[model samples]
Target: MHAKLGLFFLFLSLAAIAPLHAAEPAPPTANATDAASGAPTDAATEAATEAQSSANAGAQIPDTLEQRLLACAACHGKQGEGIAKSEYYPRLAGKPAGYLYNQLRNFQEQRREVPIMTYMVAYMSDDYLREIAAHYARLQPPYPAPAGGYPEQELARGEALVRKGDADKNIPACSACHGKSLTGMEPTIPGLIGLNREYIVAQLGAWKTGHRHGAQPDCMSQIASRLSPRDVAAVSAYLTTQRATADSMPALARSARLPIDCGVVPGASSADPELGIAVPEASGESFGKDGKDSKEPGS
Candidate 1:
């Protein structure tokens, strides 16, 4: 009995002195997470996996100018073409950079009253505006053929107004200031072609309502004021149908003086009707003080 007791004490000492070690690896994936606690390991594994996934997602999204442009793309289109399957969005691609720049500035300054545009541009700086404008101006996307049909009589009237104004109204032809083919003049005037009919109508209405504004004389306001609803509809539809010719591109230089003393034009006279200043009436045959005429090559 004493020998057995002595052997038992020896065994106990041996058990205590044996090098301590962790328990055998817990049963596979099921018990690996919490050997001490009574909980499943898979939940912890899933949580860790989720955390890793979140980190990867964060890493994938880096802030960039391209990211900022996404906001513009949402409304204007991915390429800034402004053709987003919507009627009101105009074709912004390949527009004159200066013209685009001015419009962006107008939106930001609230001079042009587009609520969405104003809100989007509220925080954009002048330099950023120029950048965005330049980006769109550089893109030359293909223009789709004009859509929708109008009455032939209205179309004829529209064409007449675009090419030759009604002599009775003292209004000059649309081509006189907007290039011979209804394209824009550099540094200010926008191209009339490749624009949505609805957009044109909307802008004309805005001008008529004094919601849209430009430089001192605001020639658009004056021009739109004289237009009847029929005239506006006719002109907008006609202009949209016409495509730009080689010469339809915006003129780089202000080669000729404006037909009337338009404040926005590069070299206009003091013919401010808005400021109570008297101006000369424009005629199809002749315009401005010099007999340069509205149909002159430079004009």
Candidate 2:
């Protein structure tokens, strides 16, 4: 009876030990077939998944047009007033939609030579350009002129140059092409009002330096070359200070004093009753007849 009891106790101990061993999970076996097939390991698969996630995040980094335009508002003002001191960015508000659209296209196509503008426009499409232009054009122009005062004498000088040609230099009055009010004529020309001084100076400088070339017989280039540094400064200063008045009359009159009926002739008026110029119907061969090809590269 004593031997049987001892054997029974030993059997109980063995049963407890067996359960302890059984509770531990078995070591996983590597499948030779999977290894031979060269399947990715769990760690590698995890790493790949993480890399893909990172790539997706990177791809989403560019801002949408609305966001970019919002960023533009900081420097350009809420309504595209343009930076007061920095003339590099022009006031986009109140510009003709077609003019704005062309400029945006020019920047994107590298026809315009501004590095910053090129980058800003690089990824933008035609539709995006039109949308941005339309948004800005619809905004009302800011009321009241810039607070800073411009020199009266300089302003007078600029006005004189713009209204009356410096015949000695063969420089025609800017109004000859830009119109009496300096607000550009319809369908092509752009206005000069509300522009930042820096932009005006830069554009004039570009024309003079050949950095901004236009198509054949570049009018701006010719005019810019004739202008002295003082003239550029004076003109820009004067223009920047002037405010557009609602009562201001258009530059051209119903009748002009030019000898020819051609559109290219200085002082020639437009025939369109609405244009107030006596300009003859444009013969199929006018300078800007081909709208797409009219502008010079980098204009």
Candidate 3:
């Protein structure tokens, strides 16, 4: 009876030990292969499965417009307010949607040539470009303070040129197209405020050098060509000193025609009574065809 009890206990011990051995993971040996065929061992297959799972987990980021546009915030601010004192990047916030759209098209078409900009828009469709433009146009963050340190003479000249043009030089006042307050006119023209002098100068220089182009009969190119180096400097200086206010929002569509024909502005190239477009005023007085002085905000 004692011998029989010892054998039964030994059998129970063997059973427990067998399961423990079976539960332990098998060590993979060199050139290990499946017993049925010459295929990779289960250990290799398990490792591959684990790697694939990790890859799938890494790809789980949400695909959204905001996520795609995170790259833009690197150069332009999160709110589309360009970097302060950056010469190349300008504020996109609160700009007219049409103007912003045209610029994206320009970059895509190589009419404007910033290498990075060109690359960014290379594969974008027109609708996608419009969406991007609209996104930035809707942003209205507070602007950084205007930079100063320009000479008084230059500032005065700039003010004169901006408010009242040099008739003898055939230079129309900037306000004629930019609005009396120097806030941009709606649908096309961009605001001149909140930009650094260097950026403004660089743009004018680009136009002069034929490095930039807009729609045919590009009025900016014409205007830029006519400006002397000193004139450009004066205008940039004055524009950089002005502060943006609550009334600084873009002006409504022009009641009077633009001082010059701009391809970007709808119906600006010709007078279409149906479109309510009028002829440009040589004097840059912002007067309508009916001889009414069409005043703008803050005028």
The lDDT leader among the candidates is 3
Off by over 4 Å in 2: 1-68, 85-88, 143-152, 245-298
Residue 18, model 1, lDDT: 18
- Per-residue lDDT of 4-120 in model 2, one digit per residue for the tens? 332232233222321221111111221111011123323224434443464467654233444345434533555766544312235666654545666766667755565445555
Report lDDT (CA) for all predictions. 0.56, 0.50, 0.60
Give the per-residue lDDT digits (tens) of candidate 3, residues 178-256.
7766778666678899876666776777777777787765878888777887888889889988899633677666445
| Most TM-score-accurate candidate | 3
Residue-level lDDT tens digits of model 1 in 113-180: 66556655666655566666668777776666665578889899999998877788876678777767
Candidate 3, residue 15: how far the Cα is off, in Å: 62
User: By TM-score, how accurate is candidate 2?
Assistant: 0.59
**Candidate 2: deviation at residue 212, Å?**
1.8
What RMSD, rounded to one decimal, does every model reach?
26.4, 27.2, 24.7
Task: Please estimate how well model 3 matches the true structure, expressed as its whole-model Cα lDDT.
Answer: 0.60
lDDT of 2 at 238: 73
